[model samples]
Target: MDAAFAEYLDEFTRRDWETLDPDAVADPVRVAVVGLGWFAREWALPGIARSAYTEATVVTDVDAGAVEAVAAERDLTGVTPEELRSGAAADEYDAVYVATPNATHLEYVEAAAAQGKAVLCEKPLEVTPERARELVAACHDAGVPLMVGYRMQTDPAVRRLRDLLDAGVAGDVIHVHATMSQTMLGELGSDTDQWRLDPELSGGCAVMDLGVYPLNTTRFALREDPVRVSGRTRSEHEAFADVDEHASFRLEFPGDVDAFCTVSQNAQHASRLEVTGTDARLILDPAFYEREDRGFAVVRDGTRVDVDFEQVHQIEEEFAYFGHQLLAGEPFHADGEHALTDMRALDGVYESAETGRPVELGD
Candidate 1:
């Protein structure tokens, strides 16, 4: 734990920890959301508003006018990135929520960490592994908490499956398959310069954007990193004229388990996860983006297991967990190292795809 936050705990006794007012800790972590993009406005902001451990303290972006507009609507003070860079603005929050473009995420993370605030960065930490390593190092040097926003890990079904794996309910995992696809080609359009379409800026579209869900889920299920990866890419639509519209990859984990992932920007709405072990298998439908809103079934042995999870908003659940782990002074699950590990495997996926060969991974 950082000395800064540790001091706060010194004020509380063990009894205080147990009897402390829940409302006192509710929205205890003041968060500065660094972007006003779609995800930020629609998902992250609302989640913070409803969180028991976090509150939206500030909103920032390079475009002052747009930020000001959002500030007016959300009753938040909008600050510009340039203002933060020039030190015109003081750090006013406990942590940062980075929902900016992939290219700009590291800068905001570093800026927030400069003031010793924790950070929750959106998924696919960087366009490349090198930048991800740098971000991880920055958080380490600052001694601030760093969590990657792999919200799938917050889902009840996903967590239950992870538990089952730990309990050996699925016996020994033998094979896994994950698929995440949406008709995003139309949403992203065919613009060659769109941030999502530009490999240099947003990284590869389907693989880097949507592929991380399956890849990370596989690792979470196994609780181990892939020793090797084999990948291949195909472009079947003009919508992805400049980038690969589809990518398929494989991860070789220990115990001779193989994980196959298929990703696409042109496919229909398809999000499913399956894991086969020696004794049984677990299946998750609409896996990547599932909340209890429309019930996500956890099927095993040809029957629906009656697992119950509180139906809180997905983002709220994630932020609540982040806040809990931070205040408890513990290492988090989706830490920088976790994201960096995913980046390494993802980088290997691309390399293998390009060379049409399997890329061996290293610890």
Candidate 2:
């Protein structure tokens, strides 16, 4: 190989290398999906099908009709949430995936923990930090492994970015700017009665649902937590009256690393995360949504080096990672305690938004 070309290939090894294995495992972990929402039915189910380490063997939902339809179509066992809690199908699966609304996580997790089954709950663990603590404690007490679905941690590009930052490829990080937004009503087919529009179910709105992506991703990449936060929110739509439609917040991490983030449930679709370092800039365009194409690059010294890796379904990677950990008896990176920190940060943001002042989160 040419020396220059060999060095270029080495750059890719340093910047973007495949980290996930997609080959089928000898014994896959059986999962019972607890919710049949669009994301569960669409992305998550398909992702599970593609994963080598996991398989969906059972399903349940509050809506009997939806559950029946999905179970029949996929040839999966359909059970009531009550039956699951009662341990009727306890032997059929090794893990329970809780994808229900934000506030309803505790009951499902408690049920699964009682059955001595592992759990994979979607983020932000629960609507509030208090409930999140309870959920974490439940799994801890049961002596079962608990993983929160922060799928960004499993993305190949994101994993590579974290490695580069750790290697000082971007030098010391100074600041970060991120934004994520989309038209919520249209995405739900304009259903005014959706849970996301409800304050109690969705946990105060756009920031909880959308902004947490950037916030959590930042924490994962930097391996640091924010120590202070300032926030503001507004809602003009009738459907969003009880929740926020738009939100913007500034977070200050230790070492003077600051982040500015904006999110909206009623705006043009956009997502981006830019990290400014002393010697270079790293950008992940179309960062949050798993459905969008991702672009990552580092810019320095009047030159740009784009990192490329095979893009797999990020949710699929998430499931695969969880299953592999359970099968190998390894600990998870996105455990319950890791998610609780984000929940605390989110609670602080809401408080800051309401009080028109900065909120301090002890380091």
Candidate 3:
């Protein structure tokens, strides 16, 4: 970590917000939503509407019609993009969720921090490590929380996996293999020029979009940074010339554990992670950071222990947790610094792929 970021983390860790009483607080945590896109309309707004600790006070987007429609649908007052851009609406909210395209995260995050509002930004926090660090610094200097949308942190299955690993049940994790792919053709049909297809906006291709999940999952599971990464890419469509349609990478983490990840925008379906350890192997099906039925099978010497659940809604749980933290003035768990660490790992992978050589992460 950079010196400034390290200092910020130290300061954050030293503060305690759990002791604060939510009921004693005079006002609810006012929140504003930026970018009324698909994810915002479909997932984020519903989650926020259902959260009790925070109120959706305003919604903003470049398209007035879209913003107005979403605001009316969710029964929220609308804030125009002009108002947000000119800082007129900054003080109206205690926090802002930037659900814009990947490329716009930094600008919105910085703007929110400048306005003294905490921020929750969509994934791939920023396109580059420097940008991510700058956002982290801005939030730190403002003394406001900046959270990334890594919803897996709150998933029940993930929580269980973390507990099992920490308890030494998965004993000395040796290797991890994960794959995530989706049929993007229908989604991207004719709209090949969509922001997600644009390298400048999406950061990379399938790797940055879908691959970040497994990358983050592996990192979280091991609770360690990868030391090195090697990757290769393949493309089936011309629209993906600047991006990748499919890619696979190998990551070497500390303690000699290896992680193999594959992500694609052109595949038929998805596959989850399989973690191998000295004592057992854990298979997690229907992975990715959503609330879905996930099957966990523990195999020891060819004997299997199956674990299953009715699938928990991760977005709801994630927003609920964030609401509680916000209500209590608690620091964000998936804070900007943590997001920066994940972005650094992403940078290494991209660099490795471009240079055709394993990239080493610097401490």
Candidate 4:
């Protein structure tokens, strides 16, 4: 066995979710979801609605009609984002899910934290690292648990891959490759002014919207921060005047491991991670930190190993786990430091693209 894998196996063991007794916990958490947009409705709300550990207390959005429509359809109560921000509408719930645009995450998180409520904010916690750090510190001071929506961490396939790495099954990870892309919003007939294409709101184009997925997944899978980053980007449509339509970057980690990730709003579909290690290689397809139809693949010494897993909804599992952690007063899995790292890496990617040089991460 590889020495690093042996060491990991000695320190940590993979957890079995099935063996866990569901009835061991009490008091389902009351959760209020802010932002009833695309993701909030498609993934977040439905996932939470199906979970046994949480109650969807309220749904809020800037568009009252949108929120009210979802509320009526789902039989949920609706609150205005303004009301939520003013704290008058938040007292009814124990937690808040912030699914607003990237620019508004900090404000919503701050408001939620001020109410001493635990929060799960969608990815790229804030537009900048400084803002992310401030929000993190505020949550810390308020003694509220803050978790970013890196739902891949809760995915069984991802969990299994992490286990293999830790168990030395894949030996020492040498390099990681990832690709996450989707058709352009304009091509999909989406409004040109969609927040995702607005750099001012989404932070960047493809990088922040889809690139962050692979970026965060790489960091989580390796459990290391990139020391340096290099990247490039391009845009085809004038509507995406402020943001790139496609972007690619290379990241260098501490132990000489490297990761290459590319994200594009111009691509046909998406791809997952292809990790190469000294002893073996593992491939996770359709890996967007979300639930997948087929499971992940493990190859050891030229032999393909199939790891069977049930389709576990990441959003549901993540919220459930967060609720349990909150009830138990345990530290959050995706904490402030994690959110800041994502932003810092994002900053580096932008810097690298502009300067045509590798940007060293950190202040």
The candidate maximizing TM-score is 2
Clashing pairs in 3: none
The TM-score between candidate 1 and the true structure equals 0.88
RMSD of each: 7.5, 2.8, 7.2, 3.4
lDDT string for model 2 (131-154, tens) is 999999999999999999998888
- Local accuracy of candidate 4 as per-residue lDDT tens digits, 1-363: 446544433422133443334477566788999888777888898788676667788889889889879889988778777788788866679999889899999888999999999988888888878788888988999988888888887766677677777776778899999998877664446678688877778888798888888888888888788999999999887877789888999999998999999889977777789889998998888778353463577777777755555576678777777776776667777887787888988989999899999999875
How well does each candidate superpose onto the true structure, as a TM-score? 0.88, 0.94, 0.89, 0.91
Q: Candidate 2, after superposition: displacement of residue 296 in Å?
A: 0.9
**Clashes in predicted model 3:** 0
Whole-model lDDT per candidate = 0.77, 0.88, 0.77, 0.80
Please give the distance, in angstroms, between residue 232's alpha carbon in candidate 3 and its true position after superposition.
1.1
RMSD of 2: 2.8
lDDT of 4 at 115: 91
Tens-digit per-residue lDDT, 1-363, candidate 3: 235322322322121323555456456677898998877777787777665566778899988999778778878878787688567876677888888888888888888888888788888887888888887898899887888888877666666666567766668999999998887767546577687788888888788888889988878877887888888888888878888889999989988899999999988788698888987777778878353466766677777767634555567666766777877666777887777777877888778878999988776
lDDT of 2 at 222: 95
What would the TM-score be for candidate 3 when compared with the true structure? 0.89
Q: After superposition, how far is residue 23 of candidate 2 from its true place, in Å?
A: 4.2
Compare candidates 2 and 4 on lDDT and give the better one: 2
Residue pairs in collision within model 1: 27-52
- Stretches of candidate 2 above 4 Å error? 1-24
